[model samples]
Target chain A: MALIRKKIVVKNKQGLHARPAALFVQVANKFDSRITVSNDKEEVNGKSIMGILMLGAEKGTLIVIEADGEDAHSAISELEKIISAEEEK
Target chain B: MIELKGIAAASGISIGPAYKIGKEELVIEREPIKEQDIPIQIQLFEESLIKTRREIIELQKRIGLEMGQEEAEIFDAHLLVLEDRMLIEEVISRLKKEKVNVAYIFSGVLKKYIDVFSKIEDEYLKERIADINDVGKRILRHLLGKEKKSLGDLKEKVIVVAHDLSPSDTAAMHKQLVSAFVTDIGGKTSHTAIMAKSLEIPAVVGVEEATVKIKPSDLLIVDGNKGIVIIDPDEKTLQIYGQEEERLKGIAQRFLSVKDAPAATIDGRTIDIYANIEFPDEVPSVKLHGAMGIGLYRTEFFYMNRKDLPLEEEHYQAYKYVAEEMKPYSVIIRTLDLGGDKFLSQFEIPSEMQPFLGWRAIRFCLARPDIFKLQLRAILRASVHGNLKLMYPMISGIEELEQANRILEEAKEELRNKGIPFNNDIPVGAMIEVPSAAMTADILAKQADFFSIGTNDLIQYSLAVDRVNEKVAYLYEPAHPAVLRLIKNIIDAAHNAHIKVGMCGEMAGEPSFALMLLGLGLDEFSMPPQVIPELKYIIRCVTFKQAQEIAHQALMLSTGREVEEFSHAKLNEVLK
Candidate 1:
């Protein structure tokens, strides 16, 4: 088992919200890692759409992503890719 | 005849029998149930929730296929609220503890949520309260064993009289069968009103007791242009309205004959006729009414009724749809003209004492470059699809126009750097709505490619009259000497700068004012698509010389009344 953590700024126009948030959760759920995302104070399960939405992370906000499991690194990177992508899906 | 006054929601004249849409009242009574019956009550509630979910899914699918995916996404919120565990569990808890009927407990829980949601200071949250209420009402209706009434299968042409029409109700209406809409409650910007305008139907909303006084099959006359509804007219009144109706139809018929003809005066001076549209769906009406192009494609609607800001892709798709649909005809997509009277729930703007004069339109956009640049990039990308032009709204002076253009250049540069394909030569225009903008139009025109006089705001701002305020609304006059002078000044400035000027406002749509505007040297007239044909008819009937005389006389007039009287007489004389 491995633990990975990364801090990233939300670069997408709408931040980690709405469709982007759903995409993040979808990517986070693909691995068996325990993934969690947090802003300044609030931490939410990265695999839950509602939890990610409740974070209210708007564009340019600093967020922390953590994943712990065998595939933690890939999960964290894939989830980061979804949030940092500039163009809308 | 009994005349009822209301807000003029849509402009048209419709005379027909009243078709009253009776709203079914849901009767919820608290009946204490036995302990054994509690499980059955809970079962009933669950069944109703399932039923409501199914109905919403069906509506979402239908609206997605018909309107757009964004519009259908409104139901996604509804579905989310419906499946919310907190709300359902609260209702169930109340039913168990209070030992009351499911309907009563559910209503109480729904009301609590509505009250809490409504109290939120955020406008987006406030708007979402409507969705919660809508979903709650659907479940309540099912729990009470009542079916929601629909206006889908209207049998004949009739004037629909209702208390108020919900968005879903208006969406479900048989547009062809309903000749007009007269509602008991709604302002000019209400959902019903916007829907009426989009459907191209006569609508008189905010007429309190319209549903009470009007009966089914009662003869009704809805004068949407004047916001008056006449019910059960006398023979003399009927004769008068009958003649008026025939005259309007005759105008429509006469205009249709010249639909394919160019908008040229008797002396062969050509003037462009265009349509002012709020949605891409209106492009067909623009073509059907013989509009050469869309002069003002208001992009504000893209920012409406949603929590999230519109993505660049959404804006691009909308502009591309209109541009491709119009093909050879140009589509002028105006930037997001939010703030003031048209506040977006997504934008948290502080309430201003005088909103009309407050931070609005281009000022708001300039302050938020991120949002403004997104829209600009979308418009630029879409421009390559057709003859698309972009414009800014409420630009007060040269500085604002320059700043807006600077932002546009930045957006273009970003797209270029990204290797995105866009029309680099897209024409840019600015709206002269503020008195300051109209006064310094020449200086502003030097920076912009063209000018559009938005007379609705111009008249309101110039005269210092809040058009929405019924008491001072009469002071907002388009024919006022000062207004005319400002319009003339704007046109002269634009022309002197070698830029074409157009008017896309209520003043341009007015037939009596057509000669005056033409005489003022307006190169184009853009108005509601429905009025384009009549304006074209007026333009073709009069010569440039005649219009010039009318304009000169109008400028010399002392009062708005005198200008109105003179323009009316001259208009009838020239056209008749």
Candidate 2:
């Protein structure tokens, strides 16, 4: 399976912090796909809360996310949309 | 037949049926499942999680629509915690290991997390745990075969009796049905408390066990003035409370009608009464209360209520709006006072042991010259439309005052170089809330065009007691001999320099203290817009000479308690 990956800058004022990261996870859980997000040095299950929190992606911090599944293409696109939308507020 | 006492959070009372929000309990029937049925239970749990997640999001959006974003953030955080894989996977792992039904396992795991968060010290952040587990329980119930999670209809004009209300719970409450609230958990500064008061709903918080004893739709009376809750009250008791409500309401209406009336005493003393506004929407409330101007226009609301720093244009619009509305009336705008409990997203400062005594207010502004200059430029531009005066908060010494003035001077020079037209004649002032500022008021007063007493922080820092702490709340008496002496000292210092001094704290709104303030020779009194009429009535009935006499007598008392008792007694004697 091919894994789609990208690093995005958090544009929201509170950082990609707790609430927004949780929101990203909730949106990621929608599709029947396996997703993982990583900061510079660590990788975590996108659906795992401790993993997202451990990522600690603050405002202006670049975060790399990866998705691997039959639906990885659609999942990566959706995940990118969630982070870039600036609508979590 | 029983009476319960609580802290009087707000003034007024209501006699109505008790409307309990009731804890959001999971009510699902569980049946024994064979070991082979574990897979089916797991699938059901997944389905329920999806549906519950959607419902929780919808509820969160609804709350955001109702109460605004700051409150939405509270539930939004809870929603994240609810979806935590750590929590969900932990339950799933237990289900697989124990070979038990998913519903029982989920319920137990949710209970464990709730226990953990309930023990936290910070009340603001601790309330989030209740919200998180509440949604978790709802999901578990759905998996166990419960189809509905609905609270029965509330009575008309009810007072919601609860242990405490989450931000989500309070947001969902029907304002038409729920006229007031009496809760076991919360204080005046609690999020729910601030919400209730902001909505003008009579709320009495910190009533222990109010939800447990008061039955649903039971006739109840909530006395916010006296901090008493009466359950199943007799006819006479109900009538007395009803009459009192009517009287207070009549007074309120009368005040509303004359809110725009010029504030003048019967003895013909015209005192400039202004409103202390936190937001721009509150600008109209100032006019409704007949404020001659906007006294303490708190710019912090813009910083505190949102996630992002307000842009220069956004700041200009808000300042311009109030300045335009109050056209000829002076709108005293304080520069962005960030620090203490109030934080801004733009400034990066380390958290301190004593934030009130740390790099906050004018200190933060002075440190970031560009940020400080941007606000100064905005205020100056807004001043062109109205009588605008810029003030700085928490000024301790003349050096800080001079340093701040230097930045303002630099802003003016830049604007001048750019050929931008701003009100160059705008008056600058400082808040004399710190003891050092008060002690050296003569020096600071010379630098400042005027002085406003921020008594809330003044009393807190002076007495070293957080007014919110129940243990030391009694020490929060504003009329403490030391506090009164400080006020007298500041006024004397300001008057000596021909500078105006005003009060912009809770004490300014209180009727009894208005007389004492005038007696203390305060040139101005800035309070909440709603309190202007009552204070005006009190001010008109008494003369400055009489107030001075009573205030003089009060200052002679030995202890804080004696001063309070004597002042209360003397106020009644004079006002009558």
Candidate 3:
């Protein structure tokens, strides 16, 4: 199995702050694959709220995500979709 | 006795032994006992398990009666964990194998499991550890041969000093004995704060390490206004505070006596006074505080404290209750002012560069027509019970007002087609809370049947300051010249269009700004009901002409301090 890891750019103005982080987490939980997020060198469990909060990645920062398990491809696609979608009203 | 001080979370106090929640170290002390004593320890542990399960049910039942069903469920889950055979079997095995007393064994087994749940990152789930430990402590108290702590056990009034307090723990406290609460964690909008505020208890939170210094029976004084907890206050100081507390109680009673009286000037220029309520349960408080009606009935509270969206009937029942209570008085309902600091977890709103400035208030409602229409239909249906006016928040221009009006028209049409009984001529209004909305007041006034100045958001938005951010919080001044001018302009436009304008924000209750608002020609004032009598007194003391002169002087002041100074001097000059 080929494992893909990449840093997705956050484009929203408020950055990966409260609202967006909540969105990111909710989207990440929709998949069955195991996912982890890393900022610079530190990596945390994607499902762990503290890990996502500790990143404190602002707008325009790069976050690397690694996925494994059966739905890695699909999970990555969903996460990317959430990161790029317009702010939900 | 050890002494510690923390931010007051609830008012009324009691003196008792240090009931440290989340702190328990079990001592076996079995060197003097023989191997045959193990059976006694096991039997004691079994009895404690049964006692704890029964106590949990009692606590859950009491809390269910005091707070509600949902908060009671948190304790119910703890009861389930206590009754689990796996935990009981593990503890029984430990007592026999290690020759430890049942008390020590219970703590050891419970601690291991509690640690596992506490390490979880989910805040909601992590909070469950507090509940479990709460249950564990009850059982330990019985096993360790400690007396059951009851609220009635407190001999005198004392402040509760704790590292942290959960809602259930607070709900279990005696209202008469618990004078005030001091906690080491939680913010102004946390569950602790909300509960305290609802109970009208003076509470200060976020004082870290408060539980380390304050001790039981230390004669502490929690000055909630100053956010200061004075440990071991001298007799003289305590006497002074006691007298002051009594005096304030007398004044509060005086205010209550005039709560139902009409809000009118001494010369009889009657002005409408309304309450800003978030829940249907608070409607009685509005009447108790002498509110003629509800001005800003925020519908968000109905949406909050629930897992899913409220069905139309649930919404209808709440709205109808408040509307029926108000009767002939107008109940202005502001539809779901959600977003910004408050976000719904069930759904996600895309992050914006500026949520306050971008897609929020009416903008979000316009985009999600289904959610907006559901609320509209609910409001319309409730209108049949009493006079209820529907208002839109954050209207910046004529386009937004027209879009919202279009929706209201469609909602009305739907109700009419269904033959539902609703007030077809019910007044629809717009909130002049944004600088843009206030600036374009003339255009908005032409479209909106009424205008209400939401001064809290208006000041924050007008100054480009976030009130929650302490660094820029000083910038939040309702008396700022720009804010005053915007208010004046909006009032003028509304009056010119022959439309009634009212205010339902912090400014409505502030005595310093009462004269200025009246001078600007506001038709109504709405605030927390407790403030109505005092504002009415201020209004009755001065005439419209005198208030105009004060308003003119306040507007000329460049800084907030100057405006405040000017308002005080003018009020004293006129009243005296």
Using lDDT as the measure, which candidate wins? 1
Quickly count the clashes in candidate 3: 26
What fraction of the true interface does each of the listed models get right, in terms of native contacts kept? 0.00, 0.29, 0.00
TM-score for candidate 3: 0.70
Task: Indicate the worst ten consecutive residues by lDDT in candidate 1 chain B.
Answer: B119-128
Q: Tens-digit lDDT track for model 1 on B1-576?
A: 788999899988888999888875778888999999999999999999999999889887876655545466667667766766556777888888989999999988778666754554443444455566677888999999887788987889989999877666766877789989999976776656767776767899989899989988999989988999999988998888788878877866898788778999999989999998887766766788889999999988887544467889999999999999998988888888887667464665665677678888899999999999999999999988999998899998888988998999999999999999999999999999999999988789778899999999999989988887769977888899999999999999998999999989899999899999998899999898778777888889988998999899899999999999998998889767
- In model 2, what lDDT does residue B204 have? 86
Q: Tell me the spans in candidate 1 whose CA falls farther than 4 Å from its real position.
A: A1-89, B1-40, B53-91, B104-141, B144-244, B255-261, B278-289, B300-315, B336-375, B394-419, B434-440, B443-445, B460-474, B572-576
Backbone clash numbers for all candidates listed: 0, 2, 26
Model 3 / residue A53 / CA error / Å: 11
lDDT of 1 at B249: 71
Alpha-carbon TM-score of each model against the true structure: 0.66, 0.69, 0.70
Candidate number achieving the greatest TM-score relative to the actual structure? 3
Residue A33 error, candidate 2, Å: 23
In model 3, which regions exceed 4 Å deviation?
A1-89, B1-106, B109-136, B139-147, B155-170, B178-247, B301-311, B344-349, B468-471, B530-546, B565-576
Ranking by TM-score: 3, 2, 1
TM-score of 1: 0.66
Top-down lDDT ranking = 1, 2, 3
- Tens-place lDDT per residue, model 3, B128-162, is 45556677777878887787444445555566666
